[model samples]
Target: MIAIQNLTKQFGATTAVKNLSLAVNPGETFGLIGPDGAGKTTTLRVIATAMRPTTGQVTVAGIDVTHDPEAVKKTIGYMPQRFALYPDLSVLENLNFFADVFGSPRAQRTELIARLLGFARLGEFQTRLARNLSGGMQKKLALAATLMHRPRLLLLDEPTTGVDPVSRREFWDLLTQVHLDGVTIVISTPYLDEAERCQRVGLMYRGELIACDDPRQLRANLGAVVFEAHSTRALQARKLIEHRAGVRVASAHGDQLRLLLDCAERAAEIQTFFHANAISVDDWRQVQPRLEDAFVLMIAQEKQP
Candidate 1:
């Protein structure tokens, strides 16, 4: 459904995306994940025909983004990170406006808007002004507006960033239905759990894609063992062993320290190190590698001199 080759985008001397190449299959949910400045948003903008590639090629649904951006825009729906709706407009008005902008058939506008209102759970809020809606509701409204045209490909840039957990789940539930209907989706997200939901994930760092694979396969192929060390002094424990031999990466999550080690045997060595440092290890055990672990490991490797 989407193809990019040797994609590079620059602003002044700073390259936002560098020599990136990737492909997304029709009907698949492809996730782009990384830290800020990783070029996730830039890539999405280029694919949506919102920005031209400095040097390279991007195609959406067989239409070249550079040569035929207008045609390419017809095949995709782009929901940016920020809410792009007019605050003064009511939910219904915003939907209708976007429908008009996209040139939705006048004959089908009423039915299309009605179905979308119900689909987005905004039927009851149709009369509510967009500025009055909660963060989650606003995101849903934006998504509804974007889908007014019935685009085949969905490009969402962190659609659920500030949304509450329940709302995030609700949004994903809606996306699940869209995926079931075979609409190709490419989303960029900071949440690893969200990435795990995708059919495949691409890890971007320093403006380049470092890894791409199914979530399960990415975790399985991390080439490391993860161990969680629970301690009241989690941060201290992390600092002590983060750069130690055999310990690849260490991050503190609340009262526990997530340790990525080169081998299972390193677990005993980590425990020994903790003991010697007087860092109480209340609980320690091996844990399954998660998508986040794989991402951290890959980015860490990329930072190696």
Candidate 2:
């Protein structure tokens, strides 16, 4: 449903997206995963036809974005990072307004709005003003507005960034439903956990798409073993493990330290190092690598060259 080739977006001397190429199949949920300034948003904007690419081509639902952006917009729904709803408008009013903007037939507006309200779980708050809704509800409203025209593809840029954990789950549930119903979605997110939910993910770094695959495949290709270390002095444990031989990466994850070792044999050395450093090792075990681990490893390797 989406194709990008040799895409590059430049602002002044800075290139936000460089030679990035990707393709999304119909009825698939594809995620663009990366950190800030990684060009995920710039790439999405070009696909949404909101921003023109500096050099290369983008096609949405088989329509060239640069050649016919209007037609491309008609086939895709774009929800930006920030809330774009009118604060004073009631939930129903906002839906109606967007429906009108999309030229939804008067005959279909009421039924479409009703369905969207229920789908987003905002039916009870239809009479409430947009300003009165929670952050998550506001995002849902924005999504509903974006979907008013029933676009075949969704271009979402960090739709759940600041939402609470429960709301984030709810939002993804909604997205899963939409995907199941056959709306191809291309979303950008900073959350590795969220990326894991995608059918496929493209990892971006320094404006380039470095790795693209299913989450499990990416983790398996990490070429390292992951060990979870628990200690009361987690910070101290991280410090001791980071400089050890055969330890490729050590990062603090919540109250535990996640160690990426060059080989499985390094696990014993890591344990001994902690013992020698007087950093209490409450527990240590080899675990399956996560998407975050794979991403960090990809970034570290990229920096080496």
Candidate 3:
């Protein structure tokens, strides 16, 4: 339930965000995908009413963020990229503190606190100090504290950054449960796999939104034939094809190299080209397009502009 139109934010001569327009529907999870310094956090802050945009309009839960900041804050929950919990506070104490800030009644605090702890999987660590928790647990604590008020809209900025794979999976599970409960979420993350989990993704770069669609839609729009190559020289293959004609893109994925060919070419053509050059490819095959491939293509185009 958020609408951002022509959003622009500037600091001195450098604009962190420019002419950005975004709409996040209620009951849906919209992801903001970008690298560091892409203005994802600045945009989030504008929507959260924590920072004012140089020029733009932001509305949360149908309330204008600038015109009714207090109302917007009251209806939305915010979990920043950086941890915002008191280092010395115990898990239970942190929740209680936020509940009080949200004016959660003393009678309702116990139940809400219990649910928050369980959802965050911090039930056993309720007595542990925040600073003593692991990276994942610290993020969960921040999320739990943000939810202490039961806000209708959840704004999470890289909720799983720096988390181990297992913890990241667990965090996504928690988010899905929260979404089922009718809370709309808007999240920004650098992880492409994480972007796949979103209902839709907004690809951002250089202070602008380049693309917005579901991961499937993004893949379909690429219109490029893809091939996967497995070889020890995958990086070398990537470098060889980086500027090669017929091959629009080449990137290394683990031990394999994923390549993109123009619509006029075929996988057989790519193999033939590499074979003629003595690239010594071990294995190659056509494969379905992935979000990572699409993101890479998008960023590459942005650089050209």
Candidate 4:
């Protein structure tokens, strides 16, 4: 489990994290979802005991991070955003190196290496140099290295960034298996779809924790009616609706335009507005809000004050 209270991290005059308080239960998969420079990485580093906070407190598995960082490190695994693998080292070599760093007993290293290689599906590529492997394989290798000591808590910062879609799904499947086995995970991700996979999510923005809740509850609390409008003139439709009364959000999504209205009764009026503007709509219908929708709304509201 991880606990943080009023945690603030500052670098010189720039405040990275501002009064953030959070808790993660045992065996739970918690996500820190945010955009670039939103303080997700800063908060993760503080919890991992890699960086000292300007104020507040952080604890991992009953050990205070600032007071006893060495003790906290033993109970947690921290994987940074960048690839940490040595290109010249083979997959097996990298694993062996990390095992040695963790001080795995010689008697257990063989079995542990075998199990981790098998778990990460790197058995076939054990002899392949890391530089020769694909991006996804390298990430898997880094994860295997992190698991060499079998820490109780895992801290991953944007682990899936730049990975192919298929590989991202495979990586999440592995994390799900790990979570099922009772290891607590705190992962920071920019992908809303990935955030939905977490048991609970903390939405961070502008160095502050704006919203935190289960994905479903967060979407439900949007308190708006969302509609997807498909049209050849999607851009024009967005412009027409962006400044309309009761319209909370109007943005183009691919070939379609999404609208979030403050009142469900305004749906008819939206249709009327399109007709009045001489815009031909291919289709339009109210739909359930998504995590991205809720996040955008939250950010917009936060900027109001």
Candidate lDDT scores, in order, read 0.92, 0.91, 0.88, 0.90
Residue 2's lDDT in candidate 4: 88
Better of 2 and 3 by TM-score: 2
lDDT of 4 by residue, 1-305 (tens): 88899999999899999999988999999999977999999998999899998999898988999899999988989999984788999999999999888899999999999999998999999999999999998988998898889999999999999999998998998898789889999999888899999999999998999999999999999988898878888898888778889999889867798888998888788888788879876677889899999999988888785
Tens digits of per-residue lDDT for model 3, 1-305: 98899999999999999999989888999899987898899999999999998998988878888898999998999998885788899999888888888899999789989999989989999999999999988988888888888889999999898899998888888899989999999999888898999999998887999999998899998968788879777888788778877677888877898888886456676677778988877677778998988888888878874
Per-candidate TM equals: 0.97, 0.96, 0.95, 0.98
Rank ordering of all candidates by lDDT, starting from the highest = 1, 2, 4, 3
Clashing pairs for model 4 are: none
Writing each residue's lDDT as its tens digit, candidate 1 over 141-183 gives 9888888888899999999997899999999999998899899
What ranges in model 1 sit over 4 Å off? none
C-alpha lDDT of candidate 2 relative to the true structure: 0.91
| Lowest lDDT block of 10, candidate 1 | 269-278
Give candidate 2 regions above 4 Å deviation: 253-255
lDDT of 2 by residue, 197-298 (tens): 999999999899999999999998899999987877887788866777788888886678888999989888777777887778867888999899999988
Q: Quote the RMSD, in angstroms, for model 4.
A: 1.0
The candidate maximizing lDDT is: 1
Clashes of each: 0, 0, 0, 0
Instruction: Give the runs in model 4 whose Cα sits over 4 Å from its true position.
Output: none
